[model samples]
Target chain A: MMGISEYFESARIAYQAIIANKTRAFLTSLGIVIGIFFVIMMGWFLDGLDNAFDKTINAIGTDMLYVDKWSWGGSDDWRSVQKRKPISYQQALEASKKMTTAELVAPHASKWGGKITYQGNTLGSVSIVGVTAPFVNTPIGNLKEGRFFSETEDVHSVEVVILGYKVANAFFPDRSPLGEIMRINGRKFLVIGVVNKRGTIITDFIDNQVFIPIQTFMGMFGTARRGVQIAVKAGSQELLDEVREETRVIARQVRNLQPGEEDDFTINESQMFRDEISTLRLYVWGIGIGLTGLSFFVGIIGIMNIMFVSVTERTKEIGIRKALGAKNRSIMWQFLVESSTLCLFGAFIGFLLCATVIFAITSAFPDVDFLTPYVPLHLLFIASIVSIIVGIFAGLIPAYRASRLDPVEALRYE
Target chain B: MNNDIIINIEDVAKTYQMGAETVHALRSVSLQIRKNEYIAIMGPSGSGKSTMMNIVGCLDTPTKGTYLFENENVATMNDNELADIRNRKIGFVFQTFNLLARASTLKNVELPLVYAGVKKDERQQRAFAALESVGLQDRTHHKPNELSGGQRQRVAIARALVTKPSIILADEPTGNLDSKTGVEIMRLFGELWKNGNTVILVTHEEDIARHAHRIVRIRDGMIESDTINPSPAEV
Candidate 1:
C-alpha cells in the first residue's frame, strides 16, 4: 500500500506545477466551473420547488377526503362527469349524519367573480365560499381574527361573513375588520372572522376568498342549481380507507343507487393531488438531470483533454522523477492529484457563483417565496463527491499514459 | 582500501531495432568497478558511452550479458526492481542537472528520499546535510531558475548524494558549466570520493577524464583502451 506521505508528496508536486502555470490551469478548469455551477443551481431550484409543493399540499388537510361530482385532478372524460347528477347540500348533510368513521364533515359551495364592497372601497373578482361551522376545523381554514360563524348562525341563515386576510387588508387596512358590515352583491353581511394568510397553492388564491354560512349562500344564489362538496376528515390515518368506504356507501344510498349501479360522485384525497404533482416533478427532474448530465460530460471531456496535454508537456519532468527513483505508481498518482486539484478548484468557484446567484434571485423577488432557492447541505456534499469522481474518471487515461512512458524516451523528449 | 567489487559487467551488449535493422550500441563490453574508485568512461558522441553508463546505473538491462550489482544479476530484473536498485544502490547526476525547475533546492534534494517513503523531518534534515556537503546549504530555498548553472549542478549533486547510494554515476557533470565552475564541481566529486563513495564519471573531454584515477576510451561501439592514469589531475 502506498503511504500517506507519498500521496502528500505527490500533491505537493501537483501544487507546484499548477502554481507554475496559473493561466493554463485556470483555463483548463473553466468547463468544470460552469458545469458545476449549473448543476448546483438546478439542484437548489428543485429543492425550493419541492418545499413549495409540500407547503401547499400540507395546507390542504392530508387526512381529509373530498366528495364531489368531479375528481380533484380532472379526468379524461369530463363530459360524462358533468352529465352525472350534481351533488346536493341535502346529500352532504345526509352523509355527515350517516358516516361512522369521519371525525368531521363540512359541506361547502363556491361562486367565483363575486364583488365585495365596504362603502366606496370595492374588491372585485373575489371568490365567495359557503361553508358550515365545521369547515373552520379543516387545515385550510384558520382564523387570524374573531371567530367562525356558529352552528346557530348556519342553521338560522344569518347574514354573517368571514373575510380572507387580503380582502380585510384591502377594505380596512388600518383597523380590525371584525364586526364591520360588508356588502356581498348588495347583501349586507356582518364580518365575524378573518382567515389567516394561506398563500396561493398552485393556482388557488385562498387569501382572496370570503366565507359565508351555507344557508345564507343558498338564499342568495339559489341552492337548486349549484353543487355542494362534502369534505370528510378521517379520525386517524389508518381509518382513512374505512372512512372513504363509509362515505361512498352513504353517498350511494343518498343518491338511491342500487347494487351494481355506477356511482354518480368521485371520492378524492390529498394523495391524488400529490400524484399529479409528482408527475410534473418527474418531468422537471428529468430535464434538470438531462441538462446537467450533458454539461458534466462536456466538462469531463475538457478535463481529459487538458490532462493529456499536461502529461505530454511534463514528459521530461516525469523522466527526471523516474530517474530519481519514482515508481510508475508515484508518477501516476502525481498526475491524478494534479487533475483532482484542478477539479476541486473549479468546484469551489462554482459553489461561490451558485450561492451568489441564489442570493440575487431571492433578494430580487422577495414576494415570490416559492421561488427562493434552497441549497441543502446534502446537495453540497453530493456535488463535492461528484467532482472528485469526475476528476478520477477524467484523469485515469492520461495518468496511465504518463506512468507507462519509457524513461529513456521520456528523458530524450524536448 | 577494501577491494569489495560493487559492479560486475561481463560481455554486455546493447542493441536497438530501427526499422528492420538492428543497430549495435554496445559490442560485448566487460568491466568491474570497486568501492571508492573514481573512473571515467570516455567516448565521442554515438560511441556507446551512454549505453554503458545506463547499464551500470541500472536504468536499462543489457541485451545479452551478465551484469551484477553486489552479486545480484540486474539484466534479468523487471522495471520496478530496476527502479528499486536505482533508488537504493545507485544515484545519477545528469548532464543538464535535470533539477525540477519549479521546486526549491531543498525539495529537489528530497525527491529520492520521498520515493523511499522517508518521513518529512528526516528527509529534510538529510537533504540539508547533503546540500551542506555540496557547499550549497545556503542556497537550499532557491529554485533551479533562480540559481546559476553551477549552483543547479551542485543541487543535483546534493540530490544524488542524499540517498547515500553505493555508487554516484555522473554523465558529463560539468558539461554545461564554465571551466571554473566545472573545476569546482570536480573538486566536490573528489571530496565525495575521498569520503568512501564510488564515483563513475562519463565524459568526452580529456581534461575531465584526467580527473579520474582510471579512464576507459570507447569508439565505434568498442573499447579502444582501458588504463589507469598514473598522475590524476588535482583540483
Candidate 2:
C-alpha cells in the first residue's frame, strides 16, 4: 500500500510530463472531449424537456377531470366507442346540477381549420372553441385582458367572443382587442376578452384559438347532436379521485345507462397524458445513452493508445526510477494519474462547449419555453465520475506494462 | 573499519535466453566486499562488468548462486523485497546521469525518499543536505536540462546519496563527460570513500580504475585477476 504522499508525488510527476508535451496530450484527449460534450448536451436537453412537460401538465390541471365521448388516449376498439350515443350539452348541464363533489363544471365544444378575419388581415386554420362562462375558472382558461362573456349573453345566445393571446395579437397588434369586431366563418362577433398565453399545453394549440358562448356557437354553426366535453374541477386537490367517481356516477345517471351496463363516456386526467410523454422520454434517453456510450468507448481507445506511446517514450525514465528504488505500484500510479488528468481536462472543455451551445439555442428562440436547456448538478457529477472511470480503464494495461519493465533492459533502451 | 563482509557471493552465475540461443553472461563468479572498501571492476565491452553491477545492485537476480547481502540471502527475495533492499541499501549512478529531465534537481534527489514513504519536510532536508555535500546546493531548483553536463552528474550523485545507502554502485559515471569533469567526479567519489561510504566503480578506462584502492579485471564473463593497487592515483 502506497502512502498519500507517494501518490501525490506520482501525480506531480505525471502533471509535469503532460505539461512538457501539451500538444500530444491535447490531441489524445480530443475524443474524450467530444464524448463528454454529447453526454452533457443530451442531459441538458432532457432536463429542459422535463421542465416543459411539467409546465404543460400544470396548465392542464392535475385536479380536474374531463368527461368526453372519446378517450384522450387511443383505444383498441374504435367501433364500440363510435357506437355510443354522443354526450349532449343538456346532459353536461344535468350532470353538473347533480354532481356532489365538484366545485364547478363547464360544457365545451370546438371546431378547427377555420379562418378568422379583422378588416383585410386574416388568420388561417384557427381553432374555435365554444364554452360556458364557468370554463374560464379552469387551469388553462385564465383571462389576460378584457372580461368573459356574461351568463346572460350565454342564455340569450348573444354573439360575444373571447380571443386567445396569439389571435388577439394578430388582429390588434398596437391596440386593445376589446369590443373589436371579428368575422368567423363570415359571421361577425364582438370580442369581449383574450385568454392568457399557455404555451403548448399537452397537444392542444391553446394560444391559436378563439372562444365564444356555447349558445351563440350552436346558433352560428348549427349543432347536429354532436358530443360536447364536460370539464369538472374538484372541490380541492385531495378530493380529485372522489370527484371523478361522483362525476362518473352523475354522468351515468344523466345518460340513463343501466347499472350493469358499462358507461359510454370516459374520464381523463393530466396523469394519463404525462404517462404517454414518459414513454417517449424513455426512448430518447436510451438512444442518447447508447450513442454517448459508443463515443466514450472510442475515447478510451484513444487514451489507451496514447498511454502506450508515452510509456515507450519514457522507458529510460522508468528505468531510472526503478534503479532509484521505486516500487512497481509507484510507476503504475504515475501513469494512471496522467491519463485521468487528461480526461478531466477534456471533460471541462466539453462542459464549456455544451453550455455555450445551449445558451445560443435558448437565445435564438426566446419564445420557445422547451428549447431552453438547463444543466443540472447531478449531470455534472455523473460526467466527472464517468471521466475518471474511463481514465482508469484506459490507463490500466499501459501502466501495468510500465510497472513490469526490467530495470536492466529499460536502462539499456535508447 | 572492522573486517565486516557486507556482500558475500558464492558461485553466482547469470544466463540470458536471447531468442532461442542461451548466453552465459556471468560464469561461476565468487567474491566478497567489505565495509568502506573502494573497488573498481575493469573489463572490455561484453566482459560481464554490467551484469556484475546489476546483480550487486539488486536490480537483477542470479540464475544460480548463493548471494548474501548483510547476511540475508538476496537470491531468494521477491521483486518487492529486492526493491526494498535496493531502496534502503544500494545507490546507483548511471553513465547518462539518468536524472529525470523534467524534474528539478531537488526532486530528482528526493525520488528515493518519496518511494521510502518519508515525510515531505524530512525528505526535502535530506535531499538539500545531499546536494550540499556534492557542492550543488545552489542548483537544487534547476532542471537537469538547464544544467551543464558536470552539474547534471553532480545532481545524479546527490540523488544516489540521498538515502544514505550502504553501497554506491557507479557504472561508467563519467563516460559522457570530458576528462576534467571526469576527474572532478572521481575526486567526489574519493571524498565519499574517505567519509566511510563503500564505492564500487565499473569502467573500461585504466585511468578511472587507478583511483580505486583495489582493482578486479574480468575477461569473457570470468574474473581474470583481483589485486590491490600498490599506489592509487589521487584526483
User: Best candidate, DockQ-wise?
Assistant: 1
Assess each model's interface with DockQ, reporting 2 decimals per model: 0.76, 0.74
A377-396, model 2: which lDDT tens digit per residue? 68777888889889989999
Model 1 reaches what TM-score against the true structure?
0.95
Off by over 4 Å in 2: A75-85, A145-150, A171-192, A201-204, A235-238, A256-263, B1-5, B119-122, B219-224
Q: Residue A85 in model 2: shift from native, Å?
A: 4.3
Write model 1 residue lDDT over A84-104, tens digit each, in one string: 888898988988899887999
Clashes of 1: 0
lDDT score for residue A33 of model 1: 80
**Which 10-residue span in candidate 2 chain A carries the lowest summed lDDT?**
A197-206
| Candidate 2 residue pairs that clash | none
